[model samples]
Target: MTQPPLTTNQDLDSARLREAFGVFPSGVVAVAAIVDGAPIGLAASSFTSVSLEPPLVSFSIAATSKTWPTLRRCDHVGVTILREDHGEVCRQLAGPVDHRFDGLTCSVTGQGALTLDDGVAQFDCTIHEEVQAGDHVIVLLQLHAVAHAEASMPLIFHRSGFGRLSASA
Candidate 1:
């Protein structure tokens, strides 16, 4: 087989890169914690399992995110894998800072990690490490506890939109 020649294009920009990246589907998750007696969080589609033996998971957040700065200060953080029906909830989390958890039902741990009641999976974790990557920070979380609903489908992010996997798929 003949390999195609690779060409570098100077016109590649963030928008184009994002569009290209959007083709890969990813699961959505809500990373939250109780800060100063209030719930603080943000939705991220970059959540993924990193290692099984260490029970590690990772998510990437924009370096400029206002919520992450405060949320990271907590002793523990809760990560909830959003259910297929949580598209609206995901949007709300990404909206205004004060109104994020307005109508959502959530539970907070003694350590201040907060998890939505109806997520597909929930994990209580402590920050294991943080690595600076380009314009974002990759957060590695060490799980202390976890719960998941085996029958639930996760909300998916692809092509810059939210969706779900079909039963047959």
Candidate 2:
């Protein structure tokens, strides 16, 4: 049996790469902080655990991101693993900076981390390191605190859309 021709690497562009990458479903998270006395954040689908010994987590931020510059300067960053019902909240985070947290409920730590009140889980962290990749920066965060709601289902991102997982039989 022979496989069909694959898209050539030479033709790989943003659209093609995004389409190919979107085939795999990933959980979404909200990375936020209180920057200069105000809340600021962005939604990210690239969150993952990085280390156990030092209690580290990671998420990728686009190189062109305007919010990242501000959040990175904060004393701490809040990483919220969004709940399945947070589809609208995720969109708001990606929308205009002024309206991001407009009608949302959130909590801010004394250290400046900000997390959605109803997220599946939340983490308070400080920047550990930042590694620059092709078009994004991989941020490694050192976790200082964590909280969770085990019954909550996480928001998922797949094929450039939001979704949720079904329970197994």
Q: Which stretches of candidate 1 lie over 4 Å from their true place?
A: 1-6
Candidate 2 per-residue lDDT over residues 55-125, each given as its tens digit: 99999999999999888998899999999988999999999999999988899999999999999999999
What tens-digit string does per-residue lDDT give for candidate 1 at 58-146?
99999999989999999999999999999999999999999999999999999999999999999999999999999999999999999
The 0-to-1 C-alpha lDDT of every candidate, in the order given, reads 0.95, 0.93
Highest lDDT scorer: 1
Candidate 1 matches the true fold with a TM-score of: 0.95
Give me the overall lDDT of model 2.
0.93
Q: Which regions of candidate 2 fall more than 4 Å away from where they truly are?
A: 4-9
List clashing residue pairs in candidate 1: none
Candidate 1 CA-lDDT value: 0.95
In model 2, what is the error at residue 151, expressed in angstroms?
A: 0.9
TM-score per model over all chains: 0.95, 0.96
